[model samples]
Target: MKATVSWQQALTFSGKTESGFSQTLDGNGETLSPMETVLLAVGACSSIDVVDILKKRRLTIHDCQCELEADRAEEPPRVFTKIHAHYIVSGDNLKEKDVDRAVSLSAEKYCSVMLMLKGNVVITTSYTIVD
Candidate 1:
């Protein structure tokens, strides 16, 4: 879990992970802001867990999308106050109980990013399965 960031120019940066993945981050609104990247990480982390869990259950999954919403404190170091991840999962024979279990397992046990923020940030999750 190692990464680095290089200054590209005024308030912009090019970030890369040791694994060879890279993304552009900017404070001048040229790309995703640092805070926005955090939210994206939370969503991406949980969604991957959900999809993997569902697949391991032998469910036929077609698509998975995580929509995130957040609130930030209106003060210096304005950190996240609350966050929500709404998962839209499409598949065949996807039951509510299964989806619920997957979401719960990710929030409570699997998603590292979400779990790390549990104490400092209020996190909530919901899911919708379309067949």
Candidate 2:
């Protein structure tokens, strides 16, 4: 439940998670932002459930990616007012029904980030299944 972020350079940083894994975070030349980390948190939170739900349902999952969009408030400290998560799943024999159900389960109950942010942020999701 801890992490460390070290400055890598201007507008960029390297973050080490409690598990010792690392990732590079950058702002594409703008000032360093925490929004990227928030998005990553949301993605990671939902992805865990997505995979687990698919596995429990015996779905053959080849790959998955989630894209998120956030609208921030205009104030001294920007906060997300809304978030949209798009899940694109690729697999063999993937069922649209399962995908829909998995997403619903995650957003409605499974994802910790979704639950924690639910009251403050409006979260929505869409899915694309490729077979």
Top candidate on TM-score is: 1
lDDT string, candidate 2, 1-131, tens digits? 99999988877888899999987778774543577778788998998899889999987899889989899999957889999999999888998989999999999999998899888999999999987
lDDT of 1 by residue, 1-131 (tens): 89999999999999999999999999989899999999999999999999999999999999999999999999979999999999999999999999999999999999999999999999999988888
User: Positional deviation of 113 in candidate 2, in angstroms?
Assistant: 1.4
Model 1 error, position 99 (Å): 0.1
Reference-based TM-score, model 2: 0.80
lDDT of each: 0.96, 0.88
TM-scores, each model vs. reference: 0.97, 0.80
> Model 1 off-target regions past 4 Å?
none
